[model samples]
Target: MARLYDYFLGGKDNFAADRAAAEKILEVAPELPAAARANRAFLGRAVRHLARNGITQFLDLGTGLPAPGNVHEVAQEVDPGARVVYVDHDPVVLVHARALLEGQGGTGVVHGDLREPEAILRDPGVLEAIDFGRPLGVLLGAVMHHIADSERPGEIVAALREAMAPGSFLVMSHGSSEARPAAVERCTEVYRSAGLPLTPRDRDEIGALFEGFELVDPGLVWLPQWRPDLSDMIDFAAAGPQASLGLCGVGVKR
Candidate 1:
């Protein structure tokens, strides 16, 4: 399936069929492009925060297309020896990742599904990139909604929590259903039509994913509001379907 990141970023990696569906989504909710950008920004900020706090190793799950400022780039910028493992099931992402890691020593990308956290934890490449004995950052940026309700996102989170060491942090964001039902409906339809159906939950529902972890300060607010780079969230608020949902946060595994 064509990953939504490729579709959203207007990348040519997506199929013509995917592009048509993406266009329909744009027609339905114009702020989608802005929303995608905001989500990426949130990922950068969260990763930097964790890295600055001494969490050098990272496991970026459900990773989409390797954009310019990716997790490893952001983390390594903080600590030169930072190690990161980018996990995704998309074949195109895997191919690009291998090309990008030609000579990189501490950073690499692996192919895996978030639904199989155990497999990811045991993957030889992932084990090489991360150390379970030390604090790490487990990133699920803008990816949880991809898991169907049948999979129980909370359960999956718990599994991830169990796999990481104490003091590990989970940084995540999801397409929310609150305060923007129409936009959510439109995007949901777009993904569904493409055979990659997604389910956006409300604040309460999304909050459940952090059930076993200790939420960071200012827990669960709008993406722009979560330690905003500037005080200009008004533009984020105006992005209709891509409206600011403060859908990002960090949680410590205890």
Candidate 2:
């Protein structure tokens, strides 16, 4: 399988097959790179919010790639002692993360499927890096949709919700069909052809995942609208159909 990092940043780790698939997606939604950067911004802001709110433990699932502004680095900036457990099914990421975090006291990577929460939560690396009794940030950025409805996205989210302590939060950003149906539809078709299911939920369906949690301010807004970095972000936000095509939100466990 091709690693996400290969496709997300134009890296060479991708196979020719993956590159061909990515090209088809870009043909449909040309602003994908921008949307990715916007989603990364949401991850950073949400992590900062959690760290600022005294959450020092994080479980970043489906962490696509070991990019520069990684979740551990972002959280540790707020609290140097913060701990993070990064999970991904990609063997490349698994290998890379292990090497990158070598000798790093508070961080580690594990190979696991998000569908197996029990195993994931019980992994030695995860248990050692995080304390569930304390507030934890469960990050599902740009990944939940990959889990089909038959696999039960709602149930998976609810399980994560139950696992976290009160005051813990769920930070998420998902591709949607709201503002750019054509672009989203095109990309959806492309992914389906490549044997990947892309379910772009509507706002109401997206809200359903937070059924029992209290949504933070500016609830379930678009990518750039969710606590953007600056005024220029709004302008950049307005340019892409994908900006309005994705839903982002943070929900605190009550």
Candidate 3:
């Protein structure tokens, strides 16, 4: 799934199988590439916003294949002393992250599953990079949707939220079915066929994932609606709501 996502983002880390799966999905929803770009842009904006606000540590859950404008890059650009712990269950993602994403002094990679927040929270590398007593950013970009309701995704989020300190930030983006149901269904079929179950939630359900935290400006809107850049502004308006099949927001634990 990570490799398939890498293909969607035009990265070269994907295999032919990943490409095949992504191509099938693209045939169903042609706007996916644009949506992936919008989601990536949101990640950068969210990380920059948190960094600028003095949050020096970040925990990037389900960190996919290494790419430009990654969390460490964006955060370290703002403050070289900023620390980041990239966690992903996929061995391929961890290998790529450790080789290409981890930097000296402050950045590290840990192989962990998002379903088990307790193990991730107690990871030695993660603990070394982040201080639970201080404010930090927890980035769950395009990850929670992969977890089904049977997995109790809400409880998983709540556990992570419980581990966070006051003033900590939670930045998330999830696949949403609100904009175009038919398109999302078709895309979901493609993923399911590939053995990757996708459970895109509606606006209210996605919004509920932020329980116990206060939303930031432009709360839980379309991905492009959250502090869009110039290109995002122009492209999203031209593509309409379909260009934003994903919902994104940031919240602070207060």
Candidate 4:
């Protein structure tokens, strides 16, 4: 999935098999690449927004294959010393992230799963870079949907919330079953046939994921609708025939 996502983002760090699989999926839903870009675009906006709002610590869950606007790069732009810990279960992702941060102080990567919040929280690398006593920006970008309902995603998220400080923020985006239903269904079918099960939740279900936190302004909205700037709007317009299938928001732990 990581490699496939890297392909979706037009990154070069993907294998031939990954490319072939992505091409096959694209044939089913031609707009998928556009939808994927929507998530990437939103991440830039969300991280930049969070950083400007005084978040110096970031815990990015499922950090996938690194791309142009990494969380550390965006956050560190606001404060050079901003600390970020990228967590991913994939060895390739971890290797790339680690190599990228070899000499980069205040940024690190950890091998962890989204389902095991406690393990992630206790990771020495995560602990060293982040101070839990202070506000932290925990990013769950487009990862929840891949988690099966049987994994108890809500409980997993709740555990992470419980560990956050009062002023901390939860920056997240999840696949929505409500938006572009046909596109969503087609994408889901292809992914499932590829042995990847998707569990896109409805607006209400996605909203419930942020239960313990107070949503920031323009709460739980489609990708294009969530705090988009003029450039973002222009980009979205250019990426025509796209589905705004991702529901995203920034929520404070207050």
Candidate 5:
């Protein structure tokens, strides 16, 4: 799944199998590459927003293969001293993240699963870089759709929120089945065939994950509509239905 995402972002780190899978999925939804780029843009915007609002610590859950505009890169742009920890269960992602983040002050990488918030919350790597006592940003960018209902993704988010301080923020963007159900269905099947499940949830289902967190301005909306800069608006201005396929928002813990 990580490698496939890398391919979508035009990175060279993907394998032929991943390319094949991505191509197959694209056959069903050719506008997906644009969506991927838009999602990354949303992530950058969210990180910057959190940083500008005095969020000094960040826990980037399910951090995928290293790419441009990383959490630390975006956050530090606002505050040079901002601390960030990248977490992912994949060994390859961990190795790459460590290699890239090495010697970079105020940053750490941990090999952890998003499904197990308890382990991540207690992980020494996370604890070292993130102070749970203070407000922080939890970034769940385009990763929650992989967790099926059976896995109780809402509970996973609730656990993270429980650990956050009052002013902490949860910045996330998730795939939605509402925009293009047929395209999403086809893509979900492709991911499942690759042993990675995709379960795009509805607005209410995604909003439920932020039970204790109050959504900031704009609330839960399509990716392009959430505080879009001029470029973001221009990019999706002429795009197809895929532009609305993702739901994103930033919420603060009450």
Candidate 6:
């Protein structure tokens, strides 16, 4: 799945299988690459926002294949001392992360699943890099939708939220069907046929994941609308409604 996402963003780290799946999705929705780019840009903005707001530690769950403007690269750019722990269940992502992301000071990669937040929280590498008592950022960019509703994604998010400090931030982006239901359903079916089902939620359902946290400015807006810079503004204006297919927001644990 991570490789498929990397392929969507025009990264060269993906294999032929990932490219095949991505091509199938593109057949359904050609705007997917634009949406993927918007989501990646949102991640850069969110991490920069958190780092500027005094978040020195980051717990990036479901960390995908290392691409340009990654969490550590964005956060560390803001503050050189920023600590980051990249978590992912996929061995391929972990291997690539360790080769490219680790060996740098205050950064480490852990093999873990987002569904099991407890184990992730308890991992030695996570504990070494992140201080739970201090304010940190938890990034869940374009990940939760892969988890089925039957798996209780809200509970998974709540568990992570409970572990965060009062001022910690939750930076998340999710795929939604509120604007274009039929198109999104076709996209979902494409993923399902590839053995990776997606559950694109409505705005309310996506907002529910942040139940215990207070939203920052522009609460739960589309990916391009959240604290966009000049470049993002141009992209958003050019992409139009396709940019809204993925919604993103940042919330503080109050």
Tens digit per residue, CA lDDT, model 5, 196-237: 889999889999988888999999988878888888776567
Tell me the lDDT of model 2 at 149.
80
- How do the residues 37-119 of candidate 4 rate in per-residue lDDT, one tens digit apiece? 87888888998998898999999999999998999899889889899999999899999998998999889999998889999
> What digit string (tens of lDDT, one per residue) describes model 2 on residues 1-254?
23543475555566778888888888877777676777777899999989999998899999876776789999999999889999999887888788878888678898888888878888897888888888899999888878778888998888788778898899998878786888788888888898987788888988998888899998998888887778427536447534546888999998
Model 3 regions lying over 4 Å from their true place: none
Instruction: List candidate 2 stretches off by more than 4 Å.
Output: 1-6, 231-244
- Summarize candidate 1's per-residue lDDT along 145-191 as a digit string, tens digits: 88889987888898888888999999988878884787778778878
Give the range where candidate 2 is weakest over 10 consecutive residues by summed lDDT: 1-10
Question: Each prediction's Cα lDDT score?
Answer: 0.81, 0.82, 0.91, 0.87, 0.90, 0.90
| Candidate 1 stretches greater than 4 Å from native | 231-234, 237-242
lDDT of 6: 0.90
Candidate 6's residue-wise lDDT over 140-188, tens digit each? 9999999999999999999999999999999999999875788899989
With a 3 Å backbone cut-off (N, CA, C), the pairs that clash in candidate 3 are none
lDDT of 1: 0.81
RMSD of 3: 1.0
Instruction: Give the TM-score of each candidate.
Output: 0.93, 0.93, 0.97, 0.95, 0.97, 0.97
Could you tell me the TM-score of candidate 5? 0.97
Comparing 4 and 5 on TM-score, the stronger one: 5
Q: 80-131, model 3: which lDDT tens digit per residue?
A: 9999999999999988888885346689999899999999999998898899
**Model 6 TM-score (2 dp):** 0.97
Write out the backbone clash pairs for model 5.
none
